[model samples]
Target: MANRATGVPAPQLLFDGSEEKFDLWETRFLSCLHILKLKETILREPDEASDEDRWKNADCYAELVRLIDDKSLSLIRHEAADDGRKGLRILKEHYSGKSKPRIINMYTSLTKLRMADSETVTDYLLRAENIITALREAGETMSDGLIVAMTLSGLPDSFKPLAVHVTQNEDSVTFAGFKRRLRVYEESEKMKMTEPTTDNVMKTYTRQGGGHSKPHSNRKEEDANITCYKCGIKGHKARKCYKKVWCNYCKNNTHAESLCKKKGGQDGVRKVAEEQGGDQDHLFKAKYVKSDRPPGNVKMKGIMVDAGATSHIVNDINKFQSFDNSFQSETHSVELADGNKCSGIAQQRGTAVIHLLDNAGRQHTAQLRDTLYMPSYPHDIFSVASM
Candidate 1:
């Protein structure tokens, strides 16, 4: 007779359990096919649908059913759909009927499915076995090959020897044993690659000399103090003493003019000496000569004096034949100590050589030093010509 709900004659009852349980298995199988179909669709058209839509619309269970009918289950055995539903089916069939022998057979079939493709099947079986073990101990023991396959699946690619160890010793298959074997496998892999140790890492880091650890050194500190000649101080040298003295040339008590030997003047001189209680030999002599006109137009021939000079300069201006003939006129402005401006001409030809007459009337050439460009200079036109 036609069934009211399905609108077809009901098939003869084949199993003893309620139709609902069988319907559940059928629905689960269809759901797996739906998942596969959705996966293939997404792989082909990733942008077309969201992940949830693909899962909902997949037809993996239908594909599995077709695979079983055509005896092409081997073709799709390692596929995601088969792995999901087939493992569930085997477990359900094994536990559903009150048949211990049939349960063992079902387990054998499941193990065969696992061995067909070690990568996919081993992980699935491990999870299944863990669940099965938690619920009820596995009556059927695992074969050495299956255990090896399971172990190999858990280990990293470098530690394949762990799988071999498991295959060799199947009787002592415990979590602790697996961990020990994994450690051994890792050590052997490192030895094979000739990898270094923690000490080598520390040495490499330490040699860089910029790490958190202290630097390695064998040298010790030495003394750096010298005695000062003028003041007899121990912290500094005599060259750096800051005593002041009178300048006999400028008649200024601010500094001794003997040390003010710079030709142009002490317009940019940093420090000056003061009048301290000392003998004449200890004090510098003042030497100055005044003129009415600007020194740029005058001819100068005297010793090149560079005492406390920030820049090269010429003091005496009466030695050259004519200052205008020796130097081509280029407008150069200089700044004085009183913030006054003065004009000068740059020498374009040979150096403005100075022939100095010492106290003995002996002639000696004074060394021409380069002009100093102090910040006090109005413009940077105080450059000296190369001699």
Candidate 2:
């Protein structure tokens, strides 16, 4: 709007009594008055002003009435007609967030804002934007770097890496830049979860000195399509060719006599001793496989392949993809490898994420079902018996 007398443009910003817009409107209104050489009319009292100043004050009061909504105008309408300074003061008290209590409340809300578990980064940032805007409108001098810090402080541990990246560049980065980085990180995490995972290779061993044996069932029809290299058999691999191996105990060409089921008790012991060429102690055996990935920054301490364990167990609860806290029971207990037992009062069972190496020896994520929680256990145990 242009002034009819001075031909100067009046402040275009109108205040509709909105708390967030009051600060901007007031600033622009003051700037417009300064440009028109009428700021003294509102900033000075009537008694201290001259005839020209008084006339200018009246004009300024009229301009204020024109720039505000009915609700805001009503706040200063009853003031002295020429004393625009008093009217402006009345409006400032009502619309400006200068009150100590109001500013305190806004700061409190800002500090308490947190990102919920199911909330996306965009959603959380939007929610934070509202509070930050309110605080700034209240005359609080919150800097962009402080706002970024507050946003990162409210996020969960899953966003820790992203938070660190943003913090390191806080001096050079804008809040908008941090938000874009967060979105990219979130998308990458989602992609990692959806992609197919390879299963890890696990090898197990028996405590006793015995090798795998083939099943005894051998029908002629089953062997028709198969051939063995050792004995030219039609149904099995050379290692399982029973026709080529003689069993001294069974006294037959169908199988090895040492593997003969008829021989039991001391004979089995004698066969094992003969094969080893000496006596052997019956001891538990287990193999723990370390991930091929770089060990310096590995999250998991280690995974042990326990040939004797009856169930898979993990020490870290965060590794579980799905968990059942209700699986905990006081009656349950776990016996350690050292023959010590830990109470099951705090134990829980769930499906857990287990890192594994595929056939190609590449690291991949895999899930293990019915895994037991053993916080006191020294190492994560993958059970052959459980499999």
Error of 2 at 287 (Å): 17
Model 1 per-residue lDDT at 44:
48
Give the local distance difference test score of model 2. Answer: 0.63
The worst-scoring run of ten residues by lDDT in candidate 1 lies at 272-281
Per-model lDDT: 0.38, 0.63
Q: In candidate 2, which residue pairs get closer than 3 Å at backbone N, Cα or C atoms, i.e. clash?
A: 226-234, 247-256, 247-257, 248-257
User: Backbone collision count in every prediction?
Assistant: 21, 4
Predicted structure 1: lDDT: 0.38
Model 1: per-residue Cα lDDT over 307-385, one tens digit each: 2223344433332223333332346544332223445423322223444445675656644343332322212221222
- Candidate 2 residues 1-387, lDDT tens each? 567898554545677787656767888998878877888678866665678877787888877876888898777787646567777888877765468987887677678888898899889988788778767766788877888888888888998867755653325777888888888999998987898752122211224346652232433433344343223334443334445455475343433444444464234433432342211122222222345447664653436566667678887777777877656557776654423344652378888876665556666766777788765343477777567
Instruction: Tell me, by lDDT, which candidate is best.
Output: 2
The C-alpha stretches of model 1 lying farther than 4 A from their native spots are: 1-95, 110-160, 167-171, 175-387
